[model samples]
Target chain A: MDNVSQEDYLTAIYRNLDEAGEIKPNLLASKLEISNAAVTDMLRKLSRDGFVDYQKYKGIKLTGEGELYAKNMLRRHRIWEVFLHQTLGMPWDKVHDEAEKLEHSSSDEIINLLEEFLEYPEVDPHGYPIPDKNGKIKKSKTVVAITELNENDTAKVIRVNDDVKNLLSYVTKIGISLGKEIIVKDKLEYDGSVLMMIDRKEVNISNKIASNIFVEKIK
Target chain B: MDNVSQEDYLTAIYRNLDEAGEIKPNLLASKLEISNAAVTDMLRKLSRDGFVDYQKYKGIKLTGEGELYAKNMLRRHRIWEVFLHQTLGMPWDKVHDEAEKLEHSSSDEIINLLEEFLEYPEVDPHGYPIPDKNGKIKKSKTVVAITELNENDTAKVIRVNDDVKNLLSYVTKIGISLGKEIIVKDKLEYDGSVLMMIDRKEVNISNKIASNIFVEKIK
Candidate 1:
């Protein structure tokens, strides 16, 4: 659909699936803060517009065209986030809100120029893959649970899926970033607290926090 | 009015007054591609909103609040233009349309971040001054007409008011840019043509072309 609302719905669907694999109408409705009927109405419209494949109550999947459009928006969002952080020195936690507003308004010219200006960045400040102009995403091969790490095993932090602003700021304050490595030294099962050496400094992280951290294990 | 249309009208008025001292409703109508009556309707709404002062049968002027908002938009527009050019490597002539779309979409945070990213740039890609974030514009001190130059006069190219893409690209292709200095060797007044020395090489410029070039006088 040519309407902005339709585009927003498509983008929301893409984002939800990107973060959570599959999407439910109730989940989409809650995320958009709209009624389930509204989501159903738009889903039908999207399906009719050939942007989505819908199986009645089976939820929604993006058609090829829809997926490309969604990925474009995602690329724009992540690029802006990187610009905000790298160029403007914005804190990573605060760039997402700005990116959210900028992504929808960018034209293709700006997007292309940004790609060139930033030197065709593969990931955003938060370590999320930035799709290429043709909607081709570079798959990130790193996935490790902090809880599974043995002593002396090392991995670099990749991304944290949580949206808590305080948590992001806290992580940054602790000197950990997307490419920084941490070696697990000890794990206490009773308290679920893990001790690790990060940047050659000892630190303690709780189990709840450990699960939120995703890393790429060192070869 | 709390409408985007009112914002556009106010911005247009401010831009016109900035370039020229006063703005007429017909000019606004022509620029916006809307009817005079529609502009009148919106002008009344803007007056009611305290953003403009209107008089019947005469053009409207911005009130303080209106001018403030307009200047903010102008600042954002120019700053985004710089980002698209310096950081993104966009051609100078191609930045305006993208900046126009982005200016309205940017938040204060994003604009400020961009300003810092570009190290608080003073001028846009097209050599126009970018108003500071607080809407304080840097006044240009030098103005020279290229057509008025005599033989042996050295001058620096400064600002070009016109934004026609073909002309800009053509001028840029000739290795002429803002602040490039040239010494006039001969002025053939018969054809309004001039032979100028640039970078130790002589170049002939047509009268029509020479008249459009604005420069700064050398000491």
Candidate 2:
């Protein structure tokens, strides 16, 4: 994308789309932390530019062209994250924000070079699948959020939502990482937080945080 | 440094400084390809911010603080150029423009990490020295422009001016590069051009182009 903000908006829309492949303007505003009016203004611009299908007070959907553009942005972002984490030895928790700025700044040529240099990694540091050069995303396993796991259920941590600020650092502080085994110990009805056994130590995470963490069931 | 244009202006001024360590506003404007009035306005802001010493109708010089900041920016630029050229296999001629955008988007930590990843590279692809973290530049041997080489003088290319647009690509096309040895065969007094033998082939370069190519006299 030519403009940083426009690239960001498309990526956000692509990331937050619901099962029907659409997102409401209000949800987008909240995700971007921008005002609803600003979202409306940008939606009009995107519509004019043939990026999104928009109608007054309707859910926003990306046009085919917009989808390709957004997938390319994600490709750039994830490739940079891999390079930052694996090549530069940057913390995985820190790669997201760094990659965000770099995604908009880098060209496709640079990203392609990075992808090859990193040996065509399957996923980013945060465990999100990286879309290929043609915007073809690899199929990933179906996973459930930690909050959905029942007591005594065992699952392996697969992905953490990088969109939530400080979530990865907090997850790291609790001794949780990708591929870590965790067993649900208890579910609090009052606060909606989960108590899970991580590396034999009990760690309590709020339901909001747990819901943002995806895991594959083991038992 | 937070703003891209401010960082660019500082780097441009720092690179184009003459022996007196000062530059005329007009030259800076021409180098940046911006208007004279815009340069004046930004100079005022930079002066007020203590980055540069500025007064109406006088040459401009970097303050100690400005020099440090500019050196850091150059460090970032050079490190990125090395990574793009050496690590990613990007052509040396193309690294300058790519590094220009990446430099402003990167953090100090990222640059330091890159420096380490590249194993403390001393010079960029263009043979420009990379400033250390403390803003200490390594002392370089005295060199002169290719135009300064007398007829029959053999010299080794040390540096090429990366500041000039499309200069590196042109140099590459003409079979010139850092460390390439050239022997001056003739000098034209008419237009001040030089005829030199490069790689067993005679190449004639204009005085304008020759002046931008720095070399160390070997014999």
Candidate 3:
């Protein structure tokens, strides 16, 4: 049950849960980049292990034990992220992938020690909150995707979907990062791309990319 | 060729090779605590992959590629060990197991960065030499096992066989550690255990334990 694939499934389920705390098997399969049959097979195993609640043709939900496991995995991931970026001076774009592999290998003791070593970082480099030891995630400012803002909406980047492939590198190329201020210059309804002013330069981003970059409204 | 078990086999073969740079499969099985059948199965695969030159009932020898791969793994392992013990403040006894998992997960880039971050450590906390990027192990003072020291020979603990299970913890319990000075008091020819004085106190260590604890003779 504690194998790498199972651990990965738990974290993937936890990350993609909607407001209702449920996710479809199809979505889970897509997120994991596995086949539908494969997802179904794993879901059944997860259910049998008491880590997930699954019914045929229905959404998947993590059990209490499952949620705790997922959050702890997240705790390991984000802490490793902090250690790689803040302590090791690795690039933010590079830290997520490095931390992903490391998170599975590290123990709770290592995570706790890293937390103390990093002065108990509140967030990872991408600005995602770090869950505490007891699976408690500190509540931070509410954030919205850049695409949700209106024209001329001034905001500050607070978080990005670190899970998205190449998203961080693409955003970094556009001079975007945690704490960077952006002004929404225009919203193109035709292609759903947003023209935003970052670092005083105009950059147009796709709706998908804009949606992954979360920001807090400034004014 | 890059799987964890394969990597472990390569490193084990590299570490246990005799003066002629070969290891009997029986010894390898014993070292890994796996079945001889299992070791044979893996050895066949290793030979097929050109990582080893294997024959039925003959000592195993790592090919050039296998040695490079094993040394690279050692580089990852020892660098991680230094980071865990020196930078993260993990206990020396705890670092080996932690580094074992980490060695398989880290990338070459991560290992290089960690080396630079630690200012290029010459050795791990347990005193095993770290292999550099080119698989070069920096030559240092020659060391001999404490078992090899004669009566009245003073020595400074330099390296310990970190692969031996619970050896570090057991030695630590006897007040042994890197840089600790030891004076050989006597050796029992019967059991081959040695009585050594450390910190002005005498402690008798078994031959097996003494053999695992390497030191440079100071007298």
Candidate 4:
């Protein structure tokens, strides 16, 4: 595709397919914030271009070519995020937006050099696995939402599902980050808020926020 | 301007206006490698947008807003070049094309961060002055083409006027770069070639190549 919007659609479709095994036009529209008509038009074009297999009522599936394109885009995006956050010392919360802009412009040579320069990082600042040059993403260990953890269970913050700046900033302010050790002190039944101990400091996180944080059991 | 082509046109206009006092449609067309009709169309659009003062036959000039926009794009382009060459260790010959792609995508915040990260560099990798945030550029000392220096005169390489990859790569291979010390040894009248001493080694550069290099006299 000649434009970034087309790339965005391919990436969105790949992500939806990866997560849900299929993509619906209405779902794609909602995800892209575009109208159903626009989605249908794009789907037709993509199908004609052999990037997708689309049927009138059946869900959409990415063709092999589309999957490769999406994976490459993802690799560029995550690598840029790592460069901004790790090498440049930018705050993790602020890197996503910058990476989004940079990914579309990065050439293969640039990405290759960047991958080497960053010492071949496996994951981005948000703990999302980065795809290799060949679009191979190493599967990560199983992780569960913090809200799924039992009271008094200790876990390590493996990833944050939500990369929203405000949420990241809030978590950072409360001294919570990837690899941080947290103990679930209590789960309030009244409001679904979870009381946790981070670095011996007690903090209460709303269930919504808790659900967005993925953690791995320590023991 | 909403797109890169428009921004490119504005920057080209600004550069032409800065180098020469005026710009003609044909000159701009050649500079941008586009047709005269395309240049005329864009100039009209820019004129409508109040970014340029375009007359039917006389010439075109950038308005204050247009100059500012051009300066910003130039600033982003040079800063990215510096980042690619200095921070990423990319060869100078390879940075220009990469910077061209990156400049359009860099946001104000990213540029600002990059400027700070680079410790507020005054010039790009090619020794061209980088515009400040307010579009202010610090002018360098007076310089002249290398061919202008008399025999036995010492000078410091200040800038390379030509940025063509092959030319840059050749110069780089010959150990010619910004701030390099050289002494004029002889001028061959046969082909207008100049003999010079660089790092205690004698080298001969053609007049064409010599003219592309600007140097400041070493007093």
Ordered list by TM-score, greatest first: 3, 2, 4, 1
What DockQ do the predictions score, one after another? 0.57, 0.90, 0.81, 0.60
Q: How many angstroms is residue B76 displaced in model 3 relative to the true structure, after the best TM-score fit?
A: 0.9
lDDT (tens digit, per residue) of candidate 3 on A74-181: 999999999889877899999988888898898998889889989999999999999999999899999999989999999999999999999999999989989999
Better of 1 and 2 by TM-score: 2
Off by over 4 Å in 2: none
Runs with alpha carbons beyond 4 Å of true place in candidate 1 = A1-4, A18-22, A144-156, A162-167, A170-212, A216-219, B1-6, B18-21, B142-157, B162-219
Q: Number of the top candidate by lDDT?
A: 2
Deviation in Å, model 2, residue B147 alpha carbon? 1.0
RMSD per model, one decimal: 5.4, 1.2, 1.1, 3.4
Q: Taking the tens digit of each residue's C-alpha lDDT, what string does model 4 give over A1-219?
A: 656887989888876774656888888888788999999898888889988888988899988998899999999999999989887788988888788889899898899988998999999999999999899999999999999999999999999853444888888899988999999999999989999999999999999999989999988
Report the lDDT tens digits of candidate 1 across residue range A53-168: 88778967899998998888888889988887887788888888778777877887787777777788888888789999899999887687688788888998998653444677
lDDT of 1 at B119: 89
Model 3, range B1-219, lDDT digits (tens) per residue?
549999999999999999999999989999888999999999999999999999998899999999999999999999999988987899899998999999988999899888999998899898888888899889988999998999999999999888999998999998999999999999999999999999999999999999999999985
The stretch of ten residues in a row with the least summed lDDT in candidate 3 chain B is B1-10
Q: RMSD, model 3, all Cα superposed? A: 1.1
Which residue pairs in candidate 2 collide? none
CAPRI band of model 4?
Answer: medium
lDDT of 1 by residue, B100-141 (tens): 767776788788877886789988876778777677889986
